[model samples]
Target: EQVKVSKQNFLLGRGERLTDDIVIKGGGGPKEPPYTFGEARRRLSPMVSETSSRIDELPQAACPGDEAVISLTINPEYVAKSFFPHELMRDVGIEVIGSRPKKTVPEKRSRGREPSEVFTTELFARGRRAAIRNWSQQLPDWRSDRGSANALISIEEISAPVPHAKIKGSLPEQGRMALETVLHASELEFSMIQAFAAYLESQGIEADLGHSFFAKGLCFLELDAPVERADDIALFTGVRTLRQMPSLRILRPTVRSADIPTTDLELPTEGPVSEDVRVAIFDGGVPENHALTQWTSRLELPGMLPATEGFLSHGVGVTSAALFGHIDTKVPLPRPYANIDHYRVLDEAPGQDPHKLYEILGRIEGVLSSQEYDFINLSLGPCLPIEDDDVHAWTAVLDDRLSRVSTLAMIAVGNGGEGDSILGLDRVQVPSDCVNALAIGACDTPGKDWQRAPYSSKGPGRSPGLVKPDLVDFGGEFSRPFVVVAPDATPSLTTTGGTSFAAPSVLRLGTGIRAHFGSNLNHLAIRTLLVHTCEEGDQDHKENHKEIGWGRVARSLDDIILCDDDTVRVVYQGEISPAKYIRAAIPVPADPMSGMVTIKATICYKTQTDPHHPGNYTQAGLEVTFRPNDSKYSRNNQVHPNSASFFGSSLPGATEDELRRDAWKWENCLHAVQRKRGSSLINPCFDIHYNARLEGRNFAPPESLSYAMVVSIHAKGVADLYDQVVRQYATQIEPLRPVLEMPIRT
Candidate 1:
């Protein structure tokens, strides 16, 4: 009884950092060219002439002085390092916009010839287009030293505008159609789009401008056009893609609620505990009569005029879950940790308005730009599954917005898990693929035998974000439905289920952590802590990685903040400089002991995204190397200690070669655990290298990155391991404490 009480009293690190970054020096050698001069020319010449001829036919209405956009696909061998076609593109009067990774098949199945990146560049005015047409003579010599084959050899193909890559999603058979034009992010290009709209109007094709926004370096124009012109609009020059806009619907689980049972429960009337922490919920509007208005400030969006009863119930259920998790049938309910700002962004008539997707996104963006928040929850997004080649407007804009702020945002991965697997409709939805935020899925229950809910989305997300639903939490099941406050005036409760409620449930856990400790932990630290302490299934099933990534998050604050009998966990929250190496020592006992020891580390960082580059989306990545003992050195090296497999080796996919080359660098979050004999542990630490890129290539003069890492050590035979680690590291580290005391729920 005494030992249990002592362990619960001490919390983990509250941002009282204990270490500084130590720099390291490393070197590498050069590589020989893969493609010869003749082989490269054979592939690139036809593409240039085809693009030049297409540019001549393009209407000068959208481009500035008839300048157009073209794309070049690079071989995979080049994208793994710093080999680009900079000189070749510049000499041809072209300026690059950005690049995205795409699948390719070379003529010969060479060893390193795999799927690679595509660069989007601009061809200058009329004269430059003519210059490119006289290709054999006008283009530089690939054999000459001045016009080296090193860069141009990287090109696999050049893309033209009318390639049938546009026309996305399933289009409605009749009525006004909403088609979005994905144009280049250029001022002159937008003017061309305006003139093109007028030209369409003159041709008797209606093009109602809905909305537009800049994502990274691309422009998205939403227009309500006539259905008859869909085929003609797809062939427009310089327009990258044309697609049907997706609609937003209330997220409901697979199990119908008509047969689900409900029960009444009691609740507390006390207000939120924290004054510093601010949170927001973007969903359908709540009803005027509800029990949570005291801790929640409900506000309608600018154009919200009416509401639906079903939609209102969904909004109330999600908001209620954010305040109080599943109501215990046997235990009393707990009070909210902080107040909420719930913005009603959608209503019943969304189906009638083809432009509702853009309108709702605008309202959400408007609020984010105006107000600063510590936490935000989004239980809704476009009802469309994510794709491999291109990113949707909703995902691009929302990710760009979240990267600029210091807020922890949580989004629900759509309820498409029951869809047809052959068509990939079961994959995670758009905006949930935002690498900057947590895409949450739902578990069927909160007990030890929990499994992924049949309605929760599944994923092998795009490359940089392979592990899709970052974490899972208990939603409702047919037998044990989740409980929420009823829409009536009293504090009565009802049962329901969906990933929508699962999302806010995770947010509630995060807010509770902040409410208990105040400003001691930042958003990045909290994110890392959640990943570190998540409980995975006892069995090792590789396929489960897609179903519930990093397993389910800790259920209660006591489970996260309290110490175990033989284990100790600490957090490091700080910033790392670009293109540099910093080392963090894993805190262990001063002297070695008997029995086996276990070590686990988790690192999470916020990254700037390149929405156009889905495969290479995250701009920043950390390569972590674990060195167990300072005394152990490799036979071939004399300077630094040897590195053992720690982070990348445990992940399901990837060959040994790909893991070391660049695959590990693109992962924004990593977690792994290893157990070793205690005698083998002398002094352990991790070497972290920060790598930054732009458009799938090296980015010079990069900015610093915010990151958080948690490392825990557990000794098999040491019952007092936590106390020993705290005392031995007294010179550098200490336990975290709460800034204020409240009647916290156990």
Candidate 2:
């Protein structure tokens, strides 16, 4: 077919032909003759112009491939004038303002060719460098592919504004058309934006652009002007989809500030002596140079070893409180007890192997065997809501091994704060969370009052629950009296708050109790002794509640285990007053099968020699006990056994209704006292219990032969004190009293 070659058919960069027949022809105009260089004057000679021409008169032959090469040159001034078309510039919201004079390049010529040449140049910009390069790579492929069917195009560079002058590539054919389309769209969007900006600016409002993926399809017009102006513009725009630009958050370094007041809680009487009593503080080890080193004189500690790291300082602080607590006015901290031992685990690696805990147990056991330590204080732990199987296995091992050991272990409930998670009171934290461990909770310090440290982890153990934080003690706080270092000294001290501090205080009390009450101490007995010696308070007294573990803490060693003859007589000491009636539970023995026993009572007080010491006398007193009967004794003359029965009945003879009546009777007594004295008393009850081991189904090992006897004295009077009474007798009373195989007839 003889295809008519149309002048309008334009060839693409890639070998492709466009069918569009739209080409402009040059008009044939008057011609001028070529001037001879020798005939013309030099000034009048035409400037030498470079042009491509065939060297031979023969017509140009076709090359193999279907591609055409065209030559062209652009005036630098023309490109500078339209550098960034107004439409494209407005998209970025930058004004063209003006441009610098164009620098012209000398005209060039190639042998038998025109001066123009095509080459690719890379584009880049700071921050936007990646985006520009990415765009550039896509250009050639995109232009060639699309231009094959549209307008063929090429890219170029031009001078730019700001940060040195440089321009990106441009398109000559199809590319130019595509770029123009983009520019046109940007111009339309910018026009709307400018009109809105001007409207806002006139009302004293300014707007800026911000990215917002969540704005859906809507564009973000940030309120940069002012809050009121921005709000006005936003409301005025009727653009409900607009959102305020997020503000950048400011972050600044933090510096801790602390101020501690001097305390005068020291007693004139020398500290009650405690010797080679090994009390192991399980926590971060104290650096010898610490300000708290001064109190080393008072602690009954073993060799110091490191605990876990990261949060190790907490353990260090606890150790200081437990083993080396001494307060001095000018010195801030007085000399510490030189003999105390310390075990540290300052490595704070998370999820540490708990076997280390077992090793620590072994160390405590060694100390116990050597008769070096009387008690061990464990202030570090991996507290838990419920014991993990692994933890239970270890605990069972600890209970078995420790049940036979003599040293006392006092563990701290963690300081996870009273959060609903790990440390919540409902979740008893561990080693303190361990069944046999004497878990300690934090109390207000200085006056040694009851108030949970804000951070103390609390708990309601296993369902139906077991009591936790077996005891409470002063942790530390500004409101409480504590000895701390002055801020401006070469070495300074400050009061810190945490359960870490409280564990030590209770340890001191336990060690002091152990020292006062001679050897043969069992876990139950020690637990009982501490529980019996506590000074009880209301919910306001301790962190969680009155039921938070044991709601008492020992204030004086004599409160429990008073030296009487060959026996150390124990007591459950509590606050007593005229405003409230006090009731106590004393242990008595009875056959669980028979379920019958009689309760006996006594009332007396130590005679007051001096009017000064109020503790020497008591107007209200009672000794209520359940005395067990020996099976061999004849009915009438049966001498009571000093143990209590915890089974068969909730209360042996009292009907539910009768029990209620008795409760009312106790209340009446309290009311009568309050009415007479014009103030009800907040009685701290001192209930007492005693025990003896016999051949029974629930036999414990020799070390655990004795059970705990719990004596509870309360303002409201006694209620179901049997379990605690049994624990007390099993732990405290039995360990102290001699056990005979059979009853003796005198």
The whole-model lDDT of each prediction reads 0.75, 0.34
- Model 2 lowest lDDT segment of ten: 667-676
Give the TM-scores of the predictions, in the order they appear. Answer: 0.93, 0.40
Best by TM-score: 1
Clash totals for all candidate models: 1, 80
Candidate with maximal lDDT = 1
Candidate 1 lDDT score relative to the true structure: 0.75
Residues 605-699, candidate 2, lDDT per residue (tens digit)? Answer: 11101111011101122222222322323456544333242221222222343233221111000100001110111121222211111110011
RMSD values, in order shown: 3.2, 38.8
Per residue, candidate 1 scores C-alpha lDDT tens digits across 1-746 of 45332535354572225544766777666655556767777777777777778766755543445566666766655666467566776566676665555555544424445533332222211224555666534443445454645677776667665535556665666667777777656444567567657656655677787688878667888878876677656545446677777778545544445422335455676778786789999987787857788788898876676977777778888899999887775767787899999998878655666578888889999999998898999988888888876788888888888889989999999888888888889989888888888889999998888889998989867667777888899888887788778776766777888888888999999998899887778888888888788888644676887888788999788777777868888888878888877778887788885799988888888888887566677888899988888899868666668789898887644445446456768888888889988888788888888888876668854578888988888897888888888888776777777676645444
Off by over 4 Å in 2: 1-272, 288-312, 324-338, 348-372, 387-394, 421-426, 445-449, 463-465, 477-491, 516-525, 539-547, 561-704, 708-746
